[model samples]
Target: MPHSLLWSLVLAVHIISIALWIGGIFYAVAILRPSLGLLDATQRTSIMLQTMSRFFKGLTHAIPTALISGWLLILHEGGFANAPWTVNAMQAFGIIMAGLFARLYFGPFQKVRRAIRPQASAFDSIRTQMLIIMALGFLAILSACLSHPFV
Candidate 1:
C-alpha cells in the first residue's frame, strides 16, 4: 500500500478505537451502571463481568492502534519536542490515559475477574470498579476531544 493509504488506514483505526473507547464508557456510565443497581448481586455481577470482558477486549485491540496512529501523526506533523504545546499536551494526556487503562486492565479488572467467577456477592465490588474505570476512560476521551490534536 502507498504511504498515504497506510496513514489513512491508521487514522481510520484510531478514530474507530476512540469511538469504541468513548462510546463504551458512555454506555456503561449512562445505562449499564445504573441498571445494574436494580439487579440482584448474582445477576448484576455476572452481567457486569461479561460486559466488562467484552469492552476490555475491544480496548485491548484499540489501544495499540490508537497509540500507533497517534504517534505516527505526531511524527509526521513534527517530533514531540518541536510540536506546539497543545500537541505536546495531547500526547502527554494520551500517555496518562494509557497508563490508567493499563492499570484498569492489570489491576481492578483482573481482581474482579478472579473474585467473582461463581459468586454473586462479588457483584458490588465489580460494579464499583467498573464505574471507576468507566469514569476515567470518559474523562480521558473528553480531554482528547477538547484538545483537538488533529487540528
Candidate 2:
C-alpha cells in the first residue's frame, strides 16, 4: 500500500480504538456508576469488578494502538515540537493516558481482578482508579475536540 494509505489505516484504527476506550469509560463512569449505587455494596463491587475485567479485556487493544499510531503519526509529521497545537495536545494527552494505563496494567487492576469474591476495599480502589482514568480520558477527548491540527 502507499504510505498515505498505510498511515490512514493506522490512524483509523487508532481513532476507533480511542473512541471505544474513552467512550466506554465515559459510559461506565457517567452512567453506570451512579446507577450501580442502588445495589448493596457487595453486589455493586462484585458486578463492577467483573464488569471492569471484561471491559479491560476488550479495551486492552486501545492504549497500545493509540501509542503505536500516535508515534507513527508523529514520525510521519515529524515530532511533537514541530506538530500543531492539536497534535501536541494529543501527544500530551496520550502521555497522560499511557501513565494511567501503566497504573491500571501494573497496579490495582490486578488486585481488583483477583477479587472475584467481591471485596469492598478492592471495589473502592477500582472505582477510585476508574474515576481518575475517566477524568483523564475525558480531558484527552476534550483536547482532541478543541484542538485544530492545522491551526
Candidate 3:
C-alpha cells in the first residue's frame, strides 16, 4: 500500500478509537450516571459495576488501538521532532489520560469489583478519575483539530 493510504487508514483507526473512548465517557458521565440516581443503592451499584465493566473492556482494546495507530501516524509524518506543537500536546494529553486510566482501573475500579458491597466513596473516586480522564481526552481532541486545520 502507498504510504499516504496507510497513514490515512491508521488515522481513521485512531479517530474511531478516540470516538469510542471519549464517547463512552460522555455517555457514562453525562447521561447514565445522572440517571443512575433513580435506582436504589444495591441496584445502582450493580448496574454501575456492570456498565463500567463493559466500557472498560472496550477500553482494553480501544486504548491500545488508539496509542499504536497514533504512534504509527506520527512516525509516518516524520517522527515527534517533525510534528506540530498541537500534535505534541495531544500526545502529552493522551499519555496523561492513559496513566489516569491505569490508576483508576487498579485502584477504585478493582476495589469496586472485589467488594461484596461497594461503598459510595469507592464509586465517587472512580467517577472523579473518569472525569479527569474525560477532560484530558477532550483537550486532546481539541489539540488534534487545531493541529489539522481541516479537522
Candidate 4:
C-alpha cells in the first residue's frame, strides 16, 4: 500500500479510537451519572454496573487501538529520535493516560466489578480516575494538533 494511504488509515483509526474512549467517558460522567440518580439505589447500582461493564469492555479494545495506531503514526512520521517535540510530548502524555487507565481498570474498576453490589465509593474512585484521564487526553489532542505537519 502507498505510505500516504497507510498513514491516512492509521490516523483515522487513531482519531476514531480516541473519540470512542474519551467520548464514552464524557457521556458517562456528564450525562449518564446525573440521569441515573433518578432511579432508586438498587436499580441505579444495577444499571450503572451494567453500563460500565459495556463501556469498559469497549475501552479495553479502544485504548490499545489508539495507542498502537498513534505509535505507528509516529513511526510513519519518523521514529522518536527524529520526531518533533510536540510528538514526543504527545506520546508521553498518551503513555501517562494509558497508565492512569490501567490503574483505574485494575484498582477501582476491579472493585466495582467484583462487588455483589457496586459501591458508591468505588464509582467515585472511577470517576476521579476518569477525570484525570480525560484531562490528559485533551492535552494529548492539543499536542497533536499543534505538532501536526499540516496544521
Q: What is the C-alpha local distance difference test score of each model?
A: 0.71, 0.76, 0.91, 0.87
Q: How much is the lDDT of residue 122 in candidate 2? A: 61
Question: Any idea how many clashes model 4 has?
Answer: 0
lDDT by residue (tens digit), candidate 4, 44-123: 88888889889988989999999999889877777868988888888898889889888988888888889888778888
Q: In candidate 1, which residue ranges exceed 4 Å CA deviation? A: 1-5, 116-151
Give the per-residue lDDT of model 2 (tens digit) for 1-151: 9988998998798889888878887787778878999998877877677777788877777788887887888888777668778667777777787787678766877876665564676656666776787777777777777764465
- Candidate 1 per-residue lDDT, tens place, 19-133, comes to 7776776787578878888988778778888998998888888877777788887787667777766556656665666776777778767877887364544445544554665
Q: What TM-score, computed on C-alpha atoms, does each candidate reach?
A: 0.76, 0.79, 0.95, 0.93
Residue 79 C-alpha lDDT in model 3: 94
Per TM-score, the best of the predicted structures is: 3
Worst 10 residues of 4 by lDDT: 72-81
User: Using lDDT as the measure, what is the rank order of every candidate, best first?
Assistant: 3, 4, 2, 1
Name the runs in model 4 displaced over 4 angstroms.
Answer: 149-151
Q: What C-alpha lDDT does candidate 3 achieve relative to the native structure? A: 0.91
Superposed model 3: Cα runs more than 4 Å off: none
In candidate 4 the C-alpha lDDT for residue 66 amounts to: 91
